[model samples]
Target: MSQKRVLITGAAGFLGSHLCDKFVSEGYFVIGMDNFITGDSKNIAHLTGNSNFRFIEHDVTNYINIEGDLDYILHFASPASPIDYLKIPIQTLKVGSLGTHNCLGLARSKGARMLIASTSEVYGDPLVHPQTEDYYGNVNTIGPRGVYDEAKRFQEAITMAYHRFHGLETRIVRIFNTYGPRMRLNDGRVIPAFMGQALRGEDLTVFGDGSQTRSFCYVSDQVDGIYKLLLSDYTNPINIGNPHEISIKDFAEEIIQLTGTDQKVIYQDLPIDDPMQRQPDITRAKDILGWEPKVGRAEGMKKTFEYFKSLTEEELYKSEHKDFTNYHK
Candidate 1:
């Protein structure tokens, strides 16, 4: 059989870089694309000389032009973290809408299968426990978090519309809280923020009385599930995440122990529209793709902590928020 070529947007980001590695190792020509707005070059630096990989530095919000026959497109080009989306809300909306459109157009033109990176945020502050695909989320469209939540929701709607009206081969994965190597230390997410604090010997911050819960899937397991969903016959959305849940307060304790730190946990006001509970119902993934997370939280957290510990003192002390003024379309 001939080799397959896949284009992965957001290829320099945490999950995107891992996906690029997976495709290349599977013997496919991988085209890695990113605008570097939130993605770091170091994430994909290792793939520079690989014959199976090529990098394109471009924003997906504009028209995308690929030179050859493409077999698949994974639309993962969005500012995924709270600090990122909040800082660049307009860009986030544009990427989810315009970026997704360009990718869909490219996929249809090339007769390539397409997969979009949706998020558990689509179920925004869900009323249901252990959110399933069928649950319609309770989201505040005008709230601070709405930029990202609505973007993904609109992303899902457009993807499904294309699938039904145009008969396009489309897949969507509702990714939950994922943590692992390459996660920005200063990103406002709980994992990186907590770990960064621990590494620097600062008190871990817990928002909203620390009762809010999150389920974090290791990056490797998340990539595996996405890979399976992309190749499966099912065209509908599937939740890819670890259903293992933990409250923020408890999770803070876990991190303190893991880092062997002497810092204590400090409570803070929760950000507006932050989800009180976040967990995925992976029943569909299990039945359809035969996929489920294998890495336990302890094992995964340890591995991730080690990665953060290896960072230089400069990286550990970088500002709490990234400066995005230099990024342009």
Candidate 2:
């Protein structure tokens, strides 16, 4: 059989870099593409000389052109975090709408199955406890956070349209809170924010009363599940995340213990539209792909913590988060 070739958008970002690593390790010729608005080159720099990998500096919202056969496409390009999407709301919308459209067109022309990464944020402070695939979601289209939540929702709608109307092969994975190496320390996510403060011996910031909950899947487990979903026959969305849930306040306490820092948790006002509860049902992933998270929070956090501790003093102290809206305007 000929070697399989794959295109991974956002290939330099956290999850995208990991995905490139997975495919290359599996002997696939991987094309790693990223616009780098929020992605760091350091994340994928190690693959620089690897024969099986090629890096493309381009945004998916614009036209995409590749030279040869592409067996699959993982359209992971988007401003994922609140810090990112809030800073570039227009870019976020374009990537979700225009970028997704470009990728679907490429997939159609190449006869390649495509997978667009969706998020549990679609569940938007969900009325359901542990979200399942059928739950539509509770979202505010006008809220500041809506740019991201609605984009993914719209992304899902278009994906299903492609599948039903055009006979295109498609897969969707509703990613939950994920953490590990390469997560930005100042990107305004719970895990990295807490870890960065702990590393610097500062108080861990807990938004809201800390009762807001999140389910974090280790990077390995998440990547493995995505790999399975792409190859599987299931075209609908599947939730891939650890079922283990932790309250934000309690998670702050866990970090205190993990880092053994003298700092204590401090409360702050909740961000607008933060989810009160989040945990994936994952019944479909369990039954269909036979996949469940193998790494516990403690074990995964250990690996993640060590990575943060290894960051340079400059990176650890980098307080400013870049905003590209001015440039885009």
Model 1 clashing residue pairs (backbone):
none
lDDT of 1 at 18: 92
Candidate 2 stretches with Cα past 4 Å from truth are 325-329
How displaced is residue 76 in candidate 2, in Å? 0.6
Per residue, candidate 2 scores C-alpha lDDT tens digits across 45-120 of 9999999999999989989999999999999998888988988888899999999999999999999999999999
The per-model lDDT (C-alpha) reads 0.94, 0.93
Alpha-carbon TM-score of each model against the true structure: 0.98, 0.98
Error of 1 at 99 (Å): 0.3
Worst 10-residue lDDT window, candidate 1? 320-329
Model 1 reaches what TM-score against the true structure?
0.98
